[model samples]
Target chain A: MNIKKNFRVILPVGVLALAAVAWAGSPQILQPAGPGPSTASFTAINKVFTGDWQQYGQLFTSWQGGLFNRIFLLILTIVPVVFLLHYIIIGAKSFSHAGTPIKFFGILTRFLHWLAALSFSLLVITGLMVVFGKFIGGGPLVMSGRSVHLIAAIVFCLSAAGLFLIWLKDMLPMPHDILWLLIMGGYLSKKKKPVPAGKFNAGQKVWFWLATVGGGIMAWSGYTLYSFAAPVDQIRQMAILHNLLAAGLVAFFIIHLYMSLFAVKGAISSMLTGYKSREEVAIMHSRYKI
Target chain B: MARMKFLCDVERCIDCNGCVVACKEGNQVPVGINRRRVITIGEGKPGEKSISVACMHCSDAPCIAVCPVDAIYQREDGIVLVNKKTCIGCGYCFMACPFGAPQFPSGKVFGARGAMDKCTFCAGGPEKTFSDEEKQLYGQNRIAEGKVPLCAAMCATKALMAGDANVIADAYRKRVFARGSGANAWGWDRAYGKK
Candidate 1:
C-alpha cells in the first residue's frame, strides 16, 4: 500500500516537470516583428503618429496612382462631353425681343470675375497636364505645365480672394433658395418659371461657395506641398486633399462654364459687357429689379 | 534571372560605419548625401544592436508610384532607379518613400532642393551603361560588371549581404539554423511588419 502511494506521488511530480519544460521552450512568443518604439527613424515624433502617417502613404501610392487616377480621368473626359450634349439637345433659353440693357455686373465685379475665370481655366489645363502628362511622353510639356501652374495658382488665389470679398453678401443663402434648388434652378422646367432670387441665384451661390471655399483649400494645400512646410506625412495628406479638391473643382467648373455660355442665353454677354437685356433679366432673374 | 535584394544581418554589424564610408568612396556620392548609414539602437547600453540601412528597392516602390513625370522606375532585377533627365525635382518621390531613401541636394542659398538622388544599387541610371553621362549622374555600375554592391562587399564583418533574393535568404536561413536562435532581421519588422 505504501509503495502504491509513492508511485502516485512520483507520477504527478513528473508530469508537472514535463509541462514546465515545454512551457519554457515554447518559441519566444512570436512578438510582432518590426521597428519597436525604440527603432523607428523616419519620424522624431511618436510611434503611433509615424505608423498612421505611413499608412496614408501606402493608401495614396495604391489608390491615388491606380483607381483614383483612372476614375478622375474618365470623369474628366465624360463630364464635358455630357454637358455639351445636354446643351445641344435642349437649346439655350432666349428672349423673343431685345429690350433696354441694364447694368448687371459692376466694373470691378466684371474685372474680378474674368480674372478668376481666366486663372481657373489656366490652372485646370496646367494641373491636368502635370497629373497626366507622363502618359503622353512628359518632357517639355510637363516642365512647362508645372511652371505655368505655379503662376496661375497665384493669380487664381488672388482673384478668388477678390471675388469672395466683393460677392460674399450677394451669395448668401436665402429661404427661397430651397425652392430654386427644388425646381432644378428652372433649367429643367418646360416653361420658364420665375424663381424668386436676390442678386445671385441658388445655382450661382453654390458655384461661388465651391469656387471660393474649394479654391482656397486647393491653394493652401498646394502652397503647403510646394513649400514642404509640414512633415512628410503631413505633406502626403495635403497632396491627397489637394487632388480630391481639384477633382471637385473641375466638376463644378464644367457646370459653371456650360450654364453661363449656353443654358441661359445672354449670361456670357452680361459677364463680358457688364449689362443684361431687360427682357432677359425679367425671364432669368425676375425677383431682382432691373 | 536573379531577383536582387539586400539583407543586413544586424547581429554582426559593429556600428563601425564601414559600409557608409565604402559606399561614399566607391560611388563618389556628393557631399551631405549618404547612400547608406548605420543606425545603432541602445548605444552604450545593454542589449545594443546596430544595422546598416539603404534603399531596399521595394517590390511596389512608392517612389515610382508617386513620380509625376515617370522619372523613377524599377529594373527587371528589382533595383529601383531614377532617370535624372526626366526628374522634375518636384520631390513627390521623397514624400512617398517609406524608407526616406530619396535625397535632394541643397541647391541655392534659400534651401531650395535640387534633383532627387538616392542609392541606385550601383546599377547606374537610364543612360547608356557605363557612359560618361551615367557616371556623372549615378556613381558606378558595379552590378553590370558582374560584381556585388561595394557597400555590402566591403562590409568588414560581412554583416551586409547583397545577391539574388533566394541565395541570400537560404544563406541567412542556414545561419539562423546553425545558431539555433537569434534569427530576428532588424528593420525587416519595420519595412514589412505584419498588421
Candidate 2:
C-alpha cells in the first residue's frame, strides 16, 4: 500500500468528518433549556401563551423559513469547498492497481446501495430546490421538482429499508469503531496506516444508521405533510424536525461520497463492479479480511 | 393608493360562517378548500369568540419569502396574490401562513397536491382582468369591478371588514368605542358620558 499518497487525502477528509460531527450535534432541539424570561412582567405575558403552540407559531415559521434554510445553504456551500480544497492540496489517495482485485460487495448490496444512493442524491437536489423555492421564483419547474421529490423519497425510503436489513450485522457498534472515530479512521495522518475498523468503518456506519433510521423518520414526517392527518401545528413541528435531520443526513452523505469516490482510488468500483482494488481495500479497510 | 386589508372583529363574529358561504358562492372555491373560515375559540365557554380567518395579505409575507418560484406576490394596495400558473403546490406557503390559508386541490396522480389554491383578497391573478382564463383559474376578479370582497360585502353583521386599511381601522375603532372596550374608553367618556 502507498502510505505516502494515502495520508495526503486523509487530513482534510478527517477535518470535514469532524465538522459534520460538530454541526450535527449543534441543532437547538438537542440544546439544553436556557434561562428564559427572567423578568416577572415578561413571564406574566408568557403565561398566556405558555401552553399554546399558536403562541410560538411565528417563531416556528421564521425559524424554519429563515434560520434553518440558511444553515442548509451553509452546509451545501461549505462541505464542497472543504472537499475541493483537500483535493487541490493533499490530492486523492492513489492505490496500487497491479494486484488481483477482491470480490467485496455482491450484486444485492450494489443494487441496494445504488438504488438508495441515486434516489437519495435526487432527493437532496429536489429538496433544496423546494427549500429555495422563492429564490427560484416559483414556477412549473419547481412544481415538477416537488413531484420528483415525492417520487424520489418513496424510492429512497424503500431502498434504505432494504439496505438497513442487509447491512445490520456489519453496522452494529464494535469496540474498534470508538477508536476509529477518535482518530477519524486514521485519515488525518500522513501515513497509510490501516485504520482500526470492521468491514465497514465508523463513518460508513454513521451513514448507514442515519440513512436508515433518520430516513424513516423523515419519511413519516413527509407523510404527515402530505396526509395532513395531524393539525397544522403538528405538521409544522414535523417539518422542522424533517429539515433538521436532512441537514445531518446531507452532511454525512457528502463525506461518504467524497471518501468512496475520491478519498481512495477505485473505491467506487467496489459498489459498482462489486470488486475492489486489493491494495485500496487493504489500506482503507485494514481490518477486513479478503 | 388604498392599502387593501381584512379585519375580522372577533367580538361581533357569531360563528354563522356567512363569510365562508359568500366566499364559496362568489369565488367558486374548490371543494375541500376554504378561502375563508370561521374559527370559534372557546366554542362552548362563556368567553367564546368566533373569528373569520383567511389570507391577511401581509406586507412582509412569509409565503413570498419562502416560495421557490416567487409565485406569491403583493399588489401596491398591499393585497397579496399568487400566480396559479407559477405555483407548484409545494405547501411551504401553507406551512408559512399563520391562518393556514393556502389550499391544495388533490391531484390526479397518487393524490399528490395540485397547484396551490389560495384566498386572493377577491382580486384575480396575473392574467387579464375579467378574462375567461382568469375566471377559470382564480374564480373571480371582484377587485377589478371596484367592489368590496364578496365575503365582506355580504356579511350580515359586517363582522368581517375588507377594503382600505384606514376605513377598516376607523370602523374597528368605532366598534371598540361602542362596545366600551378601547383604551380608557375615552371616546365613550366624551360621547356617551362615562359609565
Candidate 3:
C-alpha cells in the first residue's frame, strides 16, 4: 500500500489507542478518587457507585424502567397500524404461485432463519411482558416470562451465529445498495419496478446485519444483566445499550413481519418452500441471474 | 406518621463490619450475599474513611422503580421490602441500586439467577406480620415487634441509625450541634452549600 494510504488509517487508530490509554491511566479519570486502603471488594463497588456516570445511570434507569415500555407499546400498537395503512394504500405485490420458481434458500438456510425469527419473536414478547410486568400486576407469570426471555435469547444466539456465517456475503453493502435505499427498495408504491438488488436488498441487508451483529451485542448485554458481577455503572451502561438497541430491533422486526406476512403476497411462502416465483425474483432481485 | 429510614454516620463508622454480621445473623440472608456492606475509601491511607451503606429504604426507592416483577414494594412508612417468592431475580434492581443493596446468591454466567435478597429495613415482607411464612422467607419481622433493626441495635458505636426519618435527622443534627462545628463538621459546604 502507498505510504499516504497507510498513514491515513494508522494515524487515527494510533491516536485513539493513545487516548484510551491516557484516559485509563489517568489518576483523575475512572481512577479511584484517591488511594484507598487495600480493603477493596472483588466487584469494585466503591469505585462504581461514586462515579460521574452515576448521573447518566439515573438517566438510563429512567429510560429503561419508565420510558422503554411506552416506547415498546408505541412500536407494538402504532407501528403495525402504520403498516396496515401502507398495505391498504399501496396494496400487496401479488405474484402468481403457478409460475416457475427459483431456489431462493435451501432447507438448512430456512431452518436457521426460522429458528432465529421464532426465538427473536419470543424474546421480544417476553421482554415486553417483563417491561410491562408492573402494569400487568406481576406475579408468577411475569417471573416465568423472564425465564422464557433468557431461553429465547440463547436460542436466538445459535441461529444468529449460523445466519451470520451463511448470509454475510449476500448482506455485504454493495455500491448499488445506495440506489435501492434511495428508491426505498422499490417499496412504498404499487408500481412493479425492477429494484437494484442482488439476493438481498438494502433493507434486508440492514435487517440482516442488525439481527446478526446487533443480536450478538444484545445477547452480550443481556448476559451481563443476567449474571451481573460487574461494577455498578457497567450494569447501567449495559441496560441502556441493551434496551436502546432493542428499540431499533423492535421497529425493524415489525417492518420485516408485515413485509413478509402481508405487504408482499406469497412472500411468506418463499422461506417455507425455499423458492420464489419468477415474477418476484425478477422484480425484487433484479440483479440476480435467475 | 412515622416514615422509616436508615442513616449511617460516617464520623462514627469504623469499618468494623459489625452491621454486616448482625444483618446476616438476624436475617439469615442467603450465603455469599451481604445485604449490608461497609465500603472503605482510602483504606490504610491517610484520611481513610469507611461508610456503612445498604438500602437507605429510599422514599422513592430506585430498586422498587426498576423491579420488573413488582416483587419490591414500599410500605407507607417508607420501609422498602421485597417479596421473595415472586422475584424472578432478573437483576435489574441490583443494577439500578447504586448502593449495591440488592444481592444475588449466585451470579454464574450459565445458570439462572436465584431470587434477589436485600435489607428489608427490618419491617419484613408482604407476608403476615410475624407469621411463620414471613419468618421463613424474610428471616425476621422486627418492625412489627417494635424493635430497631438488628444491625443498628447491635452497633457498638451507634453509627448505623435506623428509625423514622425525622427522628434520625434530629438525632444527627443534635450530634453535629453538640460537636460545635456547625456545617463544617458535617461537610455541608462540600455536599450542599455553606449555611
Candidate 4:
C-alpha cells in the first residue's frame, strides 16, 4: 500500500482502539435521577389538556393580540392614506357628456345593498370600538361596543343573506370577465379603453364573492365565539378564524368604498338612485345590454 | 418585594380535592363556577399523578394580554386578577387562557354570559380589599391579610405550597432533598421558565 493508504487504515484502527479503552471506564450511559415528581410522568398522563399542545392556544393568543391587532391597525391607517393618494392623483372619473340615464339597480336590489352596507358599517364601527376603544374611552365603551356589535352582527348577517340570494346569478364569473381582469378593468389605462363587462365587472364580482363568503365565515365564527358553548380549543380556533376574516373583510370594505366613490363615475348613483347614465355605462361597462 | 407563586408537589397530591373544596368555600365562588380543580392523571395506574390546577398566575399572563377591554391585570406581587365590572363577559380571556382557568357563570346562548370568573389567588380584585362587594364578586382577600391562600392552607398532604417564590422554592428543595427524589414541580417550567 502507498504511505497515504497505509496511514488511513492505521488511523481507523488507532481511533477504534482509543474508543474501546474509553468505553472500558464507562460501559453504559444512564438517565439522570432528579428531585421531586417527574413532570414527564404527569404530562404523559394528562397529555391532552396539559402538554405541548396547550402552548398552541398561547401561541394563538400571541398572534391575535400582538401580530393580528397590529396588522389591523396598520390596515386601518394605511388603507385610507393609500386611497386618498389615489383619489388625489386620479380624481373621480367623470363624463363630459350627460347621456340618457338607464335604470340599472331595481328598488329591491338597491334596498338590499343599502341594508347590507348600513349593517356592515355599523358592525365595523362597533367591532373597532370593542377592539380599540380602550385608547379612547373606558369599560363602558367596551361594554356598549360589544352590545352594539351583537345587534349589528345579526343585522349584517341577515342583510348579507339577502344580498347573496338576490345577486348570486349576476355576480357569477363569465367568459368575458377574464379579459376585463387582464386590462386592469380599464381603470389604470390612460387611453379611454372600456373593457367589455356586464352590469358587474370582474372586480365587482370579486368584491361580491369576498363579501358573501367572508361574511358567511364571520357570521358563523362570531356566533360560535359569542355562544361560548363550544369546547375551549374549538372556541380558540373560532376566535382566530373570526379575527382573521374580520381583518380581511375590513380591507375589502376599503377597496369597495374606493371603487364606488371614486374609481367608477356613476357606480354610487346606480346604487343610490337605481340609475346610471347610458354614456357612463357604455364607457365603463361596454358589454352591458342597456 | 416578594414575587408570590404557587408550587404543587405532584408526588404528595392524592387527588382528594380538599384544595378545590377549600377554594370554593373560601371564595364563595358562585354555584356554576369553579376557581380551582384537581385533575388526576392515569388513575389506578402505577405512575398515576394528581395535580391541583388553578391560574398559574403566569409571569407573562396570556389572559391579561388578550383581554380586549383591559379587564384582566397582574398585581405588582404577580397575582393575576380580573375586574368583573370591566369584563364585558366576551369570553376572550376564556379562549386565551392556556390552563382553561376562566369560567363564565351562565351557559346560555347569545349574550347571557355573565362576567368572567377565575382564581384570584385569594387576593380579591380592583374593589376595596375585604369589601362585601369584593367578597361577593371575587371571593376572599387572604393575601391582603398576609395569610396563605385557603386552598394551600387546606391542602391535606401539603402538596400545594403558596407564598414568596424563594421561600416556597427553598422549602420544596428541602423536601426533595429529604426524600432524595420526586421533586418535579409540574407546570413550573411552563409558568415561569421558557422550558
Candidate 5:
C-alpha cells in the first residue's frame, strides 16, 4: 500500500480514537435528593423561574411562537413539493448518454432548489427534536431547547414561501399531464401502454398534487402544536395530523429517491449539475421543441 | 446515599398558603411563579383538604428522558435541576411532566415565552454564593449554607415538616401516640374513610 494512502486513512482513525477516550471520561448521571423546598438552596431555582414567567407570560396566550414554528415547517414541506411538482409537471427525460448535460431553468431555479434542500434538512432535524421531547435534555434543558427548535422552524417557513412564489408557475398542469398519469399508472402495473412525450408525465403530476395538499396539512398542523395556543383537544388533534403528514412526505420521498437513483439512472445528474443530455431531452420531451 | 422524598400530612395542612409564602420568601423566588403552591382538593365543601405541591423529583423523570439538549440533570441527592446556560428554553419538559411543575416565564402573548421556568426546590440556580441578581431572581441561597427549607421551619401550626423522610415519619408517629386515643391519629382516615 502507498504510504500517502496509509497516512490519510490512519489520521482519521487516530482522531476518532482520541475523541472516544475524551467522551468516555465525561461526567455521568448523579441524581440528587428530591429537591423539596429547602431553607437554604432557594435562590438559584427562583432566579430561573422569574425570567421565564416574564418571558412566557400566560400559557398558550400568544401567537408569535406559533408563527415562528409554522414558518420553518412551511419551508420544509414546500421545497420538496416544488421539486416533486417540477419533476412531475415538467417532463422527465431518461439519459441516453451517460455524461450528457441537460438544461432546465438556468440559475434561478438552481438557487431556489438549494434553499429548499437546506430548509428541508433543518425541518427534519428540528422536527425530530420536538417529537422526541426532552429525552435529549433534562427538564430545564428541554424548557429552553424547545424555543430554539421552534425559531429555526419559523425561518424555514419563510424560505418555503419564497420557493413557492418562484416555482408555482412551471407546475401548472397541461393537457398531457393527465394522460401521462394514466400511462404511468399502466406502466407501474406492468401493462403495455404508450410512453408519454410532454413537458411532464402522469406520475410527476401526481407528485405535484401530493406536495400541494400534503405541504398545506403539515404547515397548518405543525403551527398549531408549536404555538400550543389552541384548546387542548384541538392541539392533540393537530399533533396527530402533523405526524401523519410527515409520514406521507417520507413515503413520497422514498419513491422519488428510487426513481432518481436506480429506476432511472442518470436522472440525478440534472439536479447535481443543473443540466441534461440532448438525446434524453429528445426522447423524453419530443413533443415540445427545445 | 438517601433516596429523599417529601410527604405532606394533608390533614395537618390549613390551606394558609404559608408553605407557598415561605418558599417565595426563603428562596427569593420571582413573583407570579410559586416554586411550591398550596392546592385545595375539595373547594367550598365539607370534605375539603389542601396539600403543598412541588416537584416530585421522580426516580425516572420523564423530563430527563425527553430533553434533546441534555440541560436537565439529577443531582446525587436525587434533586432534578436544569443547567440554565445549556438550556435552550424549549419547554419539552413542561409537556413531559405529569404534575405541570415545569413552567415558562413567557406566556402565550408577545414573545414572552422567551425561556422555560420551573421549580428548583429552593436550591436556587447554578450560580455561586448569592449575588444581588441571584437573591432577587431566585431567593435565599440557604442550600449552599446547609439548611432545611424555610417553609417547614416557618409552619405556624407545626404541621408541615421537612427533612429525611424516615426522620419526619418517626416524629409524626410519636405525635400520634402522644394524643392518647382522643383524636384520630391519621385524620384523613377518620373523617373520609368509612360510611
Candidate 6:
C-alpha cells in the first residue's frame, strides 16, 4: 500500500521530469557542411548514416567558440544579486507567517518562489543573445554579444533544476486542489461561495504546475541547442521546437507577472516581505491552515 | 596612411594560377591555407575565364562585424587584419565571408581549426616590422619594404592589377571598350550568386 501510494505520486512527476529533460536537448541553429557540395542530408546518430549531422555539429562548435566565455561571466555576476534579493528581502517574513495570526508565504514556499523568478530571468536574457546575436549589432558586435548569451543560458538551466526541486511538493496534484479549482472560478465570478486553504490554494497550485511544466520544456530544448554534438536535422527540428517553447514560457510568465504584481493585491509584498494579513489568509487560504 | 585596395580585371584573366602562386611565395603563407586562389569558371567549356580572387578589403568588411573577440579590424591603409593574439579561432568570419577568403588551419591537426588567415593585399600583417614571426605566419611584408603586392608586380601577362580600385577599374574599362565583344561587368555576381 505504501509503494502504491508512492507510485501514484511518482508517476506524473517522473513523466514531467523526463519531458523536461528531453525538451532541453534541442539546438538553436543547425547549418552544417555536407560531403563535397553534393550531399546535404541530415542523418541520425553515427557515421553509418550519411548527412548534415556533422555539419550542424561543426556549426554548433563555431557558435560555442564564438560566445560561451563572455556569457558565463555576465551570468555569474547577475544571478546572485537576483537570488539574494529574492531570498533575504522577499522570503524572510513569509516563513514566520505559516501558522501565525497574520499569514503569508512561508519560508520554504518563498524560497521556491524566488528561485523560479531567478532562473526564468537568466534563461530569457541569455537565450535571446544567442539566437539573435547576429541580427542585433550587425557584423562585428555579433561575436561578443553571442558568447555572453551562451554562458548565461547554462547558468539559467542550472538554476531551473533547483527551482524544480524546491517547488515539487506544492506542484503535485491534490484532491482538495481539484475541488477548489472546480468551484473557485465560479466563486470569484460570484456564482458560488469561496473555499480556502492552509499552505496553497487551488489557484496557486494551478500556477505552480504551469511554471513547472512550461519550465521543463524550456530547459530541455535549451540544452539540446547547446550540446552541439547532436545530428543536424534533429538540431534544426529542436531549434523550431525550442522557439515554440520559448513563446509559451513568455505568455505564461506574463500571466504570472500580472498575478504577482497586479491581480492579487498582497502577492508581491508576500514575496518581498513574506507576510500577509490574518483576515486575508482566513478568506483566501482557509483550506490550507496549518 | 591611405586605405589599400585591390581591383582585378575579369576580362584579361587567363585562368593561370600565376597570381595565386606569386601570392603564396610572397607571403610564405602556410600550407592548407590559401590567402589567394584562382577560381576558373565554365571549366572545360568554350566561354571559360579564370579569375584570381582574394579579400576585397571592403570599407565595411563583414568579417569585422561578426568577430566576437574584436579580432578583425581595418588598417589606416584600408587592409583588414586579424589580431591573432586576441582571436579565439571561432570561425564566425568564415561563415559570414562571401568570398570564402578566410581559411582555417584545419588539415594541420585532427580538425582543430586554426586562427583565420586571408589575403593581406601585399601590405602584410599586424606585426610592427618584417620579423621572422610575421613572415612565417603572415607571409612577406612587401608594403613595409615600399612595394606593391608581389602577385600584381610579378604578373607575366599583366592580366591581374592591384592598386587603387579607381585606377584598376579605369584600366579594365579601357580594355572593355577596346574589346567590346566579350566583357563581363559583374564577374563576381556571375561567379557566386547572392546567398
TM-score of each: 0.82, 0.82, 0.86, 0.85, 0.56, 0.49
Clash number for every model? 3, 11, 5, 7, 92, 42
lDDT of each: 0.75, 0.75, 0.76, 0.78, 0.54, 0.57
DockQ of each: 0.24, 0.25, 0.40, 0.35, 0.07, 0.07
Better of 2 and 5 by DockQ: 2
Residues B43-161, candidate 3, lDDT per residue (tens digit)?
A: 67564556777777765666777787778888878778888777877778877775667887653334667778888887778888888888877888888889999889988899788
Better of 4 and 5 by TM-score: 4
Evaluated at residue A84, the lDDT of candidate 1 is: 76
| Fnat for every candidate | 0.23, 0.34, 0.33, 0.41, 0.11, 0.00
Estimate, for each residue in A241-283, the C-alpha lDDT of model 2 and write its tens digit.
Answer: 8889988988988888898888776678778898877777787
Writing each residue's lDDT as its tens digit, candidate 6 over A206-264 gives 66665565556555655554442464445544555565556545555555664566444
How is the predicted docking of candidate 5 categorized under the CAPRI scheme? Answer: incorrect
Q: What TM-score does candidate 4 reach?
A: 0.85
Candidate 1, residues A1-290, lDDT tens digits: the string is 65765564467558857854553322212122244332332232213222543557777777666665775687689988887776777667876546668788889989988888998999988888767757766655566666677788889888889888888767766788898888877777547667777778898888898888778778877887677766666677778888888888888888888888878776798888888877776766777854
Residue A51 CA displacement from its true place in model 5, Å: 30
In angstroms, how far off is B194's CA in candidate 5?
27
A136 in model 1: Cα distance from truth in Å? 2.3
TM-score of the B chain in model 3? Answer: 0.88
Which wins on lDDT, candidate 1 or candidate 3?
3
DockQ of 4: 0.35
lDDT of 2 by residue, B143-165 (tens): 99899998899888887888987
Per-residue lDDT for B49-140 in model 4, tens only?
77788888888877788877788888999899998887777787777776768888862334457678998888999999889999988989
The candidate, 1 or 6, that scores higher on lDDT is 1
Best by lDDT: 4
- Mark the regions of model 5 whose C-alpha exceeds 4 Å error after superposition: A1-121, A125-213, A230-290, B107-112, B127-139, B170-195
